[model samples]
Structures are given as C-alpha cells and as structure tokens.
Target: MPTPLAETLTQLRIGNQKFLIDFYQRSRHLFARWAQRKHQLPPDKAHGLLQDTLLDFYDHVADGRITRMPEDLRAYLYGMAQERIAAHVPAHQPLPAAEASRRQRLLAQFNQLSTDCQQVLTYFYFRGYHFEKMGGKMGFPNATVARRQKSVCLRKLYDLVRGGYEPITGEVV
Candidate 1:
C-alpha cells in the first residue's frame, strides 16, 4: 500500500544499514557542495550539517512524522538543512559569556555522570540514535530498556544541574 519511495524510507527507518549507507553516499557530496555554495558554510560545517539533516530525516520517518515521501527528496533535505543552518549560530560567532559559562558548568556536571549514563546520553543526543539502535549499540535487551535508561540518565543530569550539585566535591550547595 506504500509507494516505492515510502517503502525505501521505511527500510531506512527499520535498520537497513546498507540502504542507509547507500542513501548517505548518494547525497553526501551533493549536499555538502550545495550547502557550502548556497549557505557559505565551510566544508566541514556543510558536511556536518548534511549528517545532522539525514539523522533528522531518519528520526522523522521512524516516528511517523513524515507520513508522505516528498516528490523531491534532495529538495526536502536541502530545505531541512537550510532551516538548521538558520537556527544555529555560525561557528565563527562567539557564544555570549554567560551562555558559555553555563555550558561549561553543564558539561562539568555531565562529566560527573556514570559511564553508562554518559554513553547513553551521548548516543541519544549527540549521535542522534533511535532507541532501538541505541539498545543494540549499548547491548541492552530491548529498546524499551534503552529508553528507560536514557530517561533516568537525563533526570539525574537535570537534578544535578537544578540542585546546584558541585561536581568536584560531589555535594549539593
């Protein structure tokens, strides 16, 4: 009942590693060049943006947010990349001092987390992994367990930050 393109996307969402690799290979260079030329991003930033865009696309497909395949997949990706570029501050721009300090504090707190907690958070947020993929990578029994672990880790992080727990002394102030 699905179009070929939709089926392909479904395959991608369901862990078809070869198809995902092919999809990235097919688009990476083209997207990198397009982003660099159109948005004036540096090569590395353009490539990074492309990677993030692809992950976002995968997430959308997995979550049923993308109910219909776009007529032009490249165009859809380009639009998403453009929006991401607009949302992010350029690398050359400096973060405000207060924001930088806050980030430093948060990162310090993050470092105090248990190794498993750190890995789970990094996998979910930085690597943009779905729960199933995260479960596989972390050797969890199932996706639900992975999701629950991530939630617990995130809650711990939130409490540490909100309660002003000192990472160095391991005490709340």
Candidate 2:
C-alpha cells in the first residue's frame, strides 16, 4: 500500500501502483474480519479476493468508464470483494483458445492502422475523449467526420481479422 496516505483513485487511474497497494492495505484487514464472520474461508482466499477487487477497480478507471469514486475506498473495496469471494473462483478467468486467438488477431490488425487512426482510437477509447475534441485536435472538419473515419478504420481492421483480405480499399501497397 502507498505509505503517503493521500492515495486516491485518481492516482490509480494515472497508472500508480502505489495507490493500488494503498487501497489493498486499507481494506484488506477489514475485509478479512468480515469474511471470517460470513465465510469459512482461508486467509489466503480472502487476500486473493481483496487483490482481485483492487484490480477490477483499476480496470474501471483505466477503461474511461469510472466517472465517480465511492466516498470510502475501504467500504467500496469490501463490497466488491464480497461479490468476488462468493464466486469461489477468480473474477476473470483466462479466455478460451478461440477467444484468445481472435483477440490476438484483432489487436494485430488494430496495430496496423495509420498513426492518426491509432491516436484517435486511443484518445476516445482509453482516455475517454469526446469526438468533438478528438476531431478538433486531429483537424477533422467536425465530429461526424471523425466518427466516420473511426468507423472506416474499424471496418478495415475487422476485414483483416476476418480474412486475409486486401488492404483497406484494395490499394496496392
């Protein structure tokens, strides 16, 4: 856990592992005691659940989806831990072979996009930038144009993943 004592979800969203550790330390003991009362779980299992909760919280922040944070990280982490512990298995299990392969292919195709397309997608998907702002920065006439460009890039990527098709628009490269 971060020893600074001012760790916040903002820090975690910014890729600070210290904040994650801080959350773990702050909530683990309380969650462990609660688990003892409600479940016949081993210490290790409870610990694992706490870790998973922290990771899930981190993912939500990084995914541009966590708009608000709970007032108390301890209570929030404990609540999420309760759901995870009840599952009796890791919260997110490994993907099956087909799904994993498909993901790899999609990622490969996405990586092959033009740099501008990659930047737009990253800002929109990872940083949660709105289309208008992205369009302005990228010099598109309007958000609609930016959105259409994104759609075209995605379609190109999808086709490449679906089959060994020609490049976007069949241009000889």
Candidate 3:
C-alpha cells in the first residue's frame, strides 16, 4: 500500500489525467481540497500556493498534459506536471500594439453591456458553465432561456464591437 502522501499524489495525478480527457468538467476533488485549504489561509500560505499550482494543473488537463502518467514515478510525474503547467500558464510578457489595441476595443464593447447581461455572459463563457446550470443560477427555467439570453447578449456585444466604441474617452471608435 502507498503512504498517505503517495495516495494524495496519486489522486492529484488521476485528476490531472481526467482533466486532460475533458476540460469542461470541474474537478470536485481538487475543489474540495481547495475549500478546505481556503479556511486555513493567512497561516496556510503554502496551501494557497499549492491551490494555485493545482489550478494551473487544471489548465494543463485542457492542454492534454496529464495522460498516462504513472504515479509510481513520483519525481518524474510531478516534474512533467510542473513543466506542462508552466508552458500552459500565460507568461508575464508584453502584448504587441495591435493585440493591445484589439483587447482595448473588446473591453470597451464589453463595458457597454448591462451589468446583468455581462455577468451572465461571463459565467456562460469565461467560467465555462453549461446552459442548464447557468440558467438555473440566473433564475431561468432551462437552458433554452439561457441560450436565448446569451444570443441576445452576444448580438448586442457584436453590435457594440461593430459600432467601434472607444475606451477612456467613451467615444465612438
């Protein structure tokens, strides 16, 4: 039988593997650990760092970095995971002018949306919530409502983008 730490590491490895297969699903095991760790924060800065590291691992699952890892090879698997996460995480690099301009334009358009619309859109897209869950959270009966609302919001956002709104000065782009 493996040691307690070994078992935990194995679970972590298994989670990373599962994530590689399907990134859309949230890892409840990891989330549970994070919730526990969250309660121990301030004094548990190390736990916080581990949580951050594990989140990066979740990102790796999306990038297919966790398939076929053998838990017995502890050092190698951990190193591989670290490498994969490092590659997947965004670097603190400067954005090109064109990219920066595009981002600014997008942000300006996004800002034009109503607060509720923005939240729904964010939850649906950025947080990767399914329509059913999103609708329930937003108090809609079903995914159909969520979908319709999303479409409406998207159209408004598209119009704002096409209309070319400007940031800072709130001028038309």
Whole-model Cα lDDT per candidate? 0.72, 0.66, 0.53
For model 3, the stretches where C-alpha displacement exceeds 4 angstroms are: 1-93, 164-173
The order of the candidates by lDDT, greatest first, is 1, 2, 3
Output the worst ten-in-a-row residue range by lDDT, candidate 3: 164-173
lDDT of 1: 0.72
| Residues 48-68 of candidate 2: C-alpha lDDT, one tens digit per residue | 777777777776775555755
Off by over 4 Å in 1: 1-3, 89-173
lDDT at position 4, candidate 2? 28
The best candidate in terms of TM-score: 2
CA RMSD per model (angstroms): 10.9, 7.0, 13.6
Cα lDDT for residue 97, model 1?
88
Clashing pairs in 1: none
